[model samples]
Target chain A: NAGVTQTPKFRILKIGQSMTLQCTQDMNHNYMYWYRQDPGMGLKLIYYSVGAGITDKGEVPNGYNVSRSTTEDFPLRLELAAPSQTSVYFCASSYLDSSYEQYFGPGTRLTVT
Target chain B: GIQVEQSPPDLILQEGANSTLRCNFSDSVNNLQWFHQNPWGQLINLFYIPSGTKQNGRLSATTVATERYSLLYISSSQTTDSGVYFCAVVSSGGSNYKLTFGKGTLLTVNP
Candidate 1:
């Protein structure tokens, strides 16, 4: 399987711009997550979905939105970009709950100017 | 909210040396995992050990849930092992299985 894949490996957006980060998994995982990592820091969850049509906020959900329309797809949207939103974003998936191992995408590096 | 902390924020070692990384949590956890972030920015799952000990190749991990601590040992490390190691956990009794991550321990192995 291709595991988890994310689109737009690198993106730069001007202030007030908007864009959607795409994530897909071939593993048919029931749980999917979006996380952001600042330089020299660990990742923080932005949003997650337990199944299709089920989404929830996480530790740092501000400035972002997400939708899970299919078991293989979960997308994150940024309405108005800000410099604070600049970070490396990762997409992950797991078969079950946290008890199960998670697989991560390569990551998308976003720069907001 | 659960708080996770990793020790030795930075370490430098020669190739073939051994090293240990630690993770400590403030509350009880239902799941714990170790990840390695390579220099190219790919996160790789090393182990999913909530409790007990597990070993893989040159790496081994042990988690003592009662004490809320975990340790990762790398034996005969190589330059490829140089990167950041992160420890994440899911607090016990939480409906959401989101993971709380520690800042991470950065390792630099020189050839």
Candidate 2:
């Protein structure tokens, strides 16, 4: 089903530069999430959406924004990239009504210079 | 915010051996999941066990919700099993789907 897909597997941005990491899932999931993982650390949630047009900040949401305009897409925006934002980003989706297990994307590795 | 802690931060095991990883949460949780992140950086769902015990092939997991802890057991390990194992959970009072991850237990299986 192509499950979940993310664009620009790797990216390098300069301080103050802005970019968006794209995430899409073909599974018709009702819940989508964005998370960042630093070296030797577990993933920290950045933002999540329950459905189209519903987005909320997560545990570590600073320096980032998100929008879920459609059921298949949830994009994370980095407004002003910082060195601290350099980490591998992951997108996940799941059906809240059933099979609550999350399916993660391949991850986008970002480096802010 | 819920706190999750995984033990044996690092471990090295020979092929065909067995190992156990533990995850402890600071508060009650409504959901728990186990994942294996391979060296190539793909997170594979191992189990969605929030409580009780479940087994799949050479791997099994047991969660004691009342105790707020979970255990993952790998039997007959192989080189393919080398990776970082994470235990994630959602606190009972808040968003049930918002997973809080433990730092993870890095497992290295040598042939």
- Candidate of highest lDDT: 1
lDDT string for model 2 (B1-111, tens) is 889999999999999999999999999877799999999888999999989999999999999999999999999999999999999987877764788999999999999
TM-score of every prediction relative to native: 0.97, 0.96
Docking class of 2: medium
Model 2 regions lying over 4 Å from their true place: none
How high is the CA lDDT of each candidate model? Answer: 0.94, 0.93
lDDT by residue (A11-108, candidate 2, tens digit) is 99999999999999999999999999999999988999999999998889999999988999999999989999999999999986644678899999
Model no. 2, DockQ: 0.66
RMSD of each: 1.1, 1.3
What TM value does model 2 have?
A: 0.96
**Which pairs clash in model 2?**
none
What shift in Å separates residue B68 of candidate 1 from its native position after superposition?
Answer: 1.0
For residues A34-103, write the lDDT of model 1, one tens digit per residue.
9999998889999999999999998899999999999999999999999999999999988874475678
Residue A10, model 1: lDDT of 100
Return the top candidate by TM-score: 1
Candidate 1 segments whose C-alpha is farther than 4 A from its true place: none
TM-score of 1: 0.97
